[model samples]
Target chain A: GEEVAQTPKHLVRGEGQKAKLYCAPIKGHSYVFWYQQVLKNEFKFLISFQNENVFDETGMPKERFSAKCLPNSPCSLEIQATKLEDSAVYFCASSQYYSGNTIYFGEGSWLTVV
Target chain B: AQSVAQPEDQVNVAEGNPLTVKCTYSVSGNPYLFWYVQYPNRGLQFLLKYITGDNLVKGSYGFEAEFNKSQTSFHLKKPSALVSDSALYFCAVSLRTGNEKLTFGTGTRLTIIP
Candidate 1:
């Protein structure tokens, strides 16, 4: 079975610092997605990419949150000037086409901004 | 806008008994529904999806979901629950073609007692 891969299962950062997370989607998967899950809450969509091109970013916080999927490289999500509220588990998911399809998720990177 | 609602926050069931987790959706057009499971400290795993064809969709780990258009629901069902089945389940939906941004529910924690 194909699987999505994420680096740094846990990250701890101080407030106003920068934090970056990486995700390598399954091979041949064209669509990738980023979501934020805050402690026992529902997941909120942050952004999505289609082969290195951003498909949707309506949920992203433009001021501090940015994500990029460079060609031939794993997708990256960077947060500048982090705040305490940014503490959550970031999930990376990938799917064949992304139309309510079978999306596989990585174990996720837990971010803690204190 | 598309959205998913999980009616129950938790469902406690005994091992070897049938279990069900209810999910409903609101979409502008014909919706595409999906179900995923998440274990503690792990990423979400794909369970099943309902696109078209038959209403009943079988998935991994002996899980199944029924797509009811009239009811606008896609409830996950298991004939015989196991303690290993204790996990969080999420329901999601997409409203239009190429709509990869999924609207997720608050999630339901299923506990199977031995």
Candidate 2:
């Protein structure tokens, strides 16, 4: 089936350790997005990429979080210094177009910072 | 800022009965509303979307949503509920133009009693 793929379904890191999650969008999809879900609550928008170029990142928590979608590699969300609050599920999504009218999601990567 | 609201935290219904999940929004520009369903450990699956035109829009499964501009609501409804429909439902909104990120509301858990 055509679906987005994410790696490290579950990850555990020390409080100060760095954590990185990856996602591969469906083939031919042009836009990719990242979102954070904490305690199974509302999703928080993190960033979006239009074919490797960042489109919007206003909701991103700067200073510790950064993401990129390289030409040949999968998109990655990396936390420079993991914090307890950063323990949550990170989902990656993709859409046929940039408007994200019908974006699809990956299974999500669960990150745990202790 | 674009935002979505799902007032009920959970909704209970019996199989074969009609079901409705409420959602409301606030946006500066025209709104693009969406509904998604999430099973256990899986990522969100697109159910329906309201972009333009008709006030009533049908989507995947047996679900449909009415886009009421005057009421500022896009409520999801299904004629007959199924036990398989039990899951976490989310309502989201995005700018019809420009912004591509989706702002999601706190999810509503739907349980269908068989």
Candidate 3:
């Protein structure tokens, strides 16, 4: 079995277009986290999920960024009408415990908004 | 809100010498501190974490972190640096529980000069 995996390691999207990234967390992991790191900006929490349920999404952009963690399926983070500000490296991490311990990160999906 | 600060944008160290990457955290509750390393164009790889008990936590690749409650710092250190140790390092903090969201520093690029 492989570790956490992400698809489309790189993505380029025009402004006003939609972009989606996918992540398959390690098997038996119950918690998944998403983060966005813009150039020179801190790695900010975008969302977190416990199984198929949303645990936290306070950092999500109210308008367009959405995410989902399906049961036994790869998780997804979709950005609609991408803006230049949305361009950044999006990372997905998973942990077996709910306590944010022993988390593992994926290769990440680099999104370039043009 | 929780956050982390990596004071140095880049840390330069000579191979075979000791190295330190400074990190400080601001969080409301007891912190679950972690250190991760990333190579160029790669995702973060967990180094070590400070959950409780020991102040000194040892992790992968000869890297370690010391969690100081009074200083609110969780600095990563390496006993003897190697050229391969050069990479981008990130410090993150979380609440006691795994469900809590993680807050990461901007990151520090460590360059071990051979």
**lDDT (Cα, tens digit) per residue for candidate 1, span B42-108:** 9988899898899999999999999999999999999999999999999988765884677899999
Model 1 chain B poorest 10 in a row by lDDT: B94-103
Whole-model lDDT, candidate 1? 0.91
- lDDT tens per residue, model 1, A1-114: 268999889999999999999999999989999999997667989999998899999999999999999998999999999999999999998888745577778999999998
Please estimate how well model 3 matches the true structure, expressed as its whole-model Cα lDDT: 0.89
Which segments of candidate 2 are over 4 A away from where they belong?
A: A98-100
Docking level for model 1: medium
Q: A-chain TM-score per prediction?
A: 0.95, 0.95, 0.94
lDDT value, residue B43 of candidate 1: 91
Docking outcome class, model 3: medium
Task: Let me know the DockQ for model 1.
Answer: 0.72
Top candidate by TM-score: 1
What is the per-residue lDDT of model 2 for residues B1-114, given as tens digits with 9 covering 90 to 100? 877889999999999999999999999868889999999988999999988888999999989999999889999999999999999999999887854778899999999999
Model 3 Cα lDDT, one tens digit per residue, B4-109: 8999998999999999999999988898999989998888899999988889999999999899999999999989999999999999888885567777898899
* DockQ for each numbered candidate: 0.72, 0.68, 0.73
Per-candidate TM equals 0.97, 0.96, 0.95
